[model samples]
Target chain A: MYGWIWRHLPGNVYVRILISTVLVVGVVFLLFQYVFPWAEPMLPFNDVTVDGAAEPLGTPRAGGAA
Target chain B: MALRALVRTLSETCITIGLVIVLFVVYLLYWTGLRAAHASDDEIARLHKQWAQGPTGSAPAHEGTAGGTRDSGHDGGTTGGADELAGDGGAGDADSTAPGHRAGESFAVMYIPRFGGDWSKPVLENTATATLRRGLGHYTGTADPGDKGNFAVAGHRRTYGDPFKDFPRLRPGDPVVVNDGDTWYTYTITARPYRTLPGDTGVLKAVPEPVDEAATPFRRSGRYLTLTTCDPEWGSSHRLIAWGRLDATRPTAEGKPDALTREGR
Candidate 1:
């Protein structure tokens, strides 16, 4: 099935270029705009406080604390 | 058949050119809109009047708060970390004190003297989409300009040419200023260095664990200025975090941002 589909695929340069561009753009949009963004944690990035002497791991996030 | 093919090819070429022209015009419109927004007459007047009254004597420094200036003066190029700035061999001072922010925009330039030369604009989180390549990212989850909680910001350190360029220069006692219209919010550097992952959960936590048993000061709660940039400046590894508290606020209409008020222990 795969061999047959590949053989039948359009060999035209313009068609190939257009299809490739669309695929590349779609992948990028999905990864950067939707997937990566959706996965970012709440307050995805914030400042950290590390105590060197104690060598203890810092505290966790305080969701919406006033 | 050949003639027909030629006509079709010509039509396709025309369409491509037309699309390119359309995109070019749209980009021009976007640029104009940004400039107008930044240079609105009222905004310019307010800044000018404020600067005239302030001790800086000149217009409020464009590099106001986070790390670089927000002024529309320079093309949005920034260096990351102290070494990059220092490596510039003293080239970062070109427009250090100049008015970088245009007029109408709610943005300010941030400059760290220790960061050498490049300055960046810490823009409102909402407006950061267009300005991300220029400087820091304002976290929407955080507090407003002066409300409370951590007013967090993130910027790239390695990629896109290090727009947070001088974030590493930040140390305890340095001033981080944010100018919005007439208000100039100043933040005093506090705490020591901390590290976290790119999406580290610990970075934006509401409050830091107490170092000592002493009671914490609530008055300084909520209001904060956070600086975040790529860690290991050369690599895309963890992030470097710097925290500052609201020390004092002075309007451009008021004289200088009182240096004494920002004096740290």
Candidate 2:
């Protein structure tokens, strides 16, 4: 079934490949850059702040009962 | 021909963009780490200066007072007429008294004989990572070194050049020396461990209740020294309290340790 579909394709190999590559890149870029950052609060990285000015990088033990 | 060229160009452009992004992130992380380390070092330096010159409170931004205690004693002590920073060793001169030792002065190189030379340096106070890394903290608020209240100091139990890694091994009378370049204040352990909550002001209240009431400080007759760290000897939950009192402060012309000057100086 794949062989028949391949033979019946409208465009040549390179054009099909280009289209597929662009689609995949667009989806991945959208997910990583826009979607993930917006839904960041739901992610595990939310708790890990990479910002410099945050409290000293201390062991969780540094988190006192206070 | 044009389509092939475009694909190759696009791939090259994407690769360059990805590399630049990666480099930028790396640079950011490196910059942050260096800033933290430098700040920590400055804090350690300031703490040493405080220990050397003593807590003058002469300028803003400097915490603690001269010849006074940091804050309180332990978990639950009353604060009536508490001149916690008073240097009660009977020497009235502010400059000569040890109360509120200077922040960063290398008064004494704390030696945990168990950890050997690599683990020794002047202790510091404050929340600075570099200062705490060196193992000294401001004893909240207490009278100056000579005063009649407990002088408290705190440090971390782990990470960023952990200095208190072996502090748990300090037995009673196992010397804790605070050297002010000219003299050494030796403290001897007197109490067993007690639990203190974080943000609990009572612990800094000048008088700490005797865990066993019999061991109380003879109704405020003797000055106290308290060592605070995160409890459990491994992790921080409550504070692990190590109580001590003025063993002796010895004047040294040479590098003679003050622990040897008890009664002779």
Candidate 3:
């Protein structure tokens, strides 16, 4: 996948390096700012509330009280 | 030659994946804390600015009526003398009419001297992940500060500034003081941190009765404060709760409460 991206980049070797650096930074920014925050609630690390949907001990029980 | 090239590519991919996983962990543990610190600072600053401007600038007409009724109700409390003095000075007017906090809006600043003299966090309106990232979150539908019910709040134990990172250190008789621009509400810890499953919402009730009995069980409805957080430091499989009761309330005009000023507690 990375090889394909490198090969398809439209630039000389130096320019390609610069472009790839920018693209990498952009990808990391998007992942940190959007993807990770959106995905965080799905993970159990930060779950502090005692609500039904976020119970991590086991599969949420049937008719479990919130 | 083909096999060698494929092996090189596969190794490169694996290394990239590993680096990304490491980066994500750093983001979770460090970067989020940085961002949350900035957010919490801004929220607290905003709250202070709003409070300094006084009630006329923000409160609606209907809120005046609400303030009147609330003041009357507070006057009937056992601590009626102070409430009456606050009312007479007109300090309670702005406090009672303080605008109802909207979702994600910060309305209070909490100080846990047990954490440190400088340990303070803005208490926002809701407990959503986004809101908790900024500071401690006031559990919606619970009692307001100084009110006659549980004024519950939740914070992260690990990341996003870890406002309650020292949650387990809280012991009975420690003080958790809150400032809502006009009054300082001091709550005395009634029990050590209680451990329970995430499904036990009873710990946030007006008169809390956690599924696991609290070390100091509350027997009556009264002004209470509950602080909750994820347990095990880095895990969220359980919740740790600390309960407190309103020990005293003084108008901010009266200066810092004794719970905050006394040393060597």
Write down the lDDT of every candidate, Cα atoms only: 0.45, 0.45, 0.73
- Cα lDDT tens digits for candidate 3, B8-70: 899999998897788788888899899999998998899888888885232342222222223
DockQ of each: 0.03, 0.04, 0.29
Instruction: Itemize residue pairs with steric clashes in candidate 3.
Output: none
Tell me the tens digit of each residue's lDDT in model 1 across A1-66: 323333565868677667667865775556544543333222222222121211122212222211
Among incorrect, acceptable, medium and high, the docking class of model 1 is incorrect
Q: Give a tens-digit lDDT track for model 1, residues B1-265.
A: 9897777778877985675456444433343335433433333355456545644332233223222322221321232232233222222222222233332233444434344432324453321323343344455444434334466665555333344546666678877766554445667777554655454444443443233323222233345666666566654456677777766555545544544333321
**lDDT for model 2, on a 0 to 1 scale?**
0.45
Q: Model 2, B56: alpha-carbon shift in Å?
A: 11
For each candidate, give the interface RMSD after superposing the true interface residues on Cα. 11.9, 13.0, 7.0
Name the runs in model 1 displaced over 4 angstroms. Answer: A1-66, B1-106, B116-122, B126-130, B159-161, B208-220, B255-265
Could you tell me the TM-score of chain A in candidate 3?
0.67
* Candidate 1 chain B worst ten-residue window by lDDT: B88-97
lDDT of 2 at B244: 75
Q: Which regions of candidate 3 are displaced past 4 Å?
A: A1-13, A52-66, B56-99, B214-216, B263-265
Please give the ranking of all candidate structures by DockQ, highest first, separated by commas. 3, 2, 1
**Candidate 3, residue B93: how far the Cα is off, in Å:** 23
Model 2 quality (TM-score): 0.47
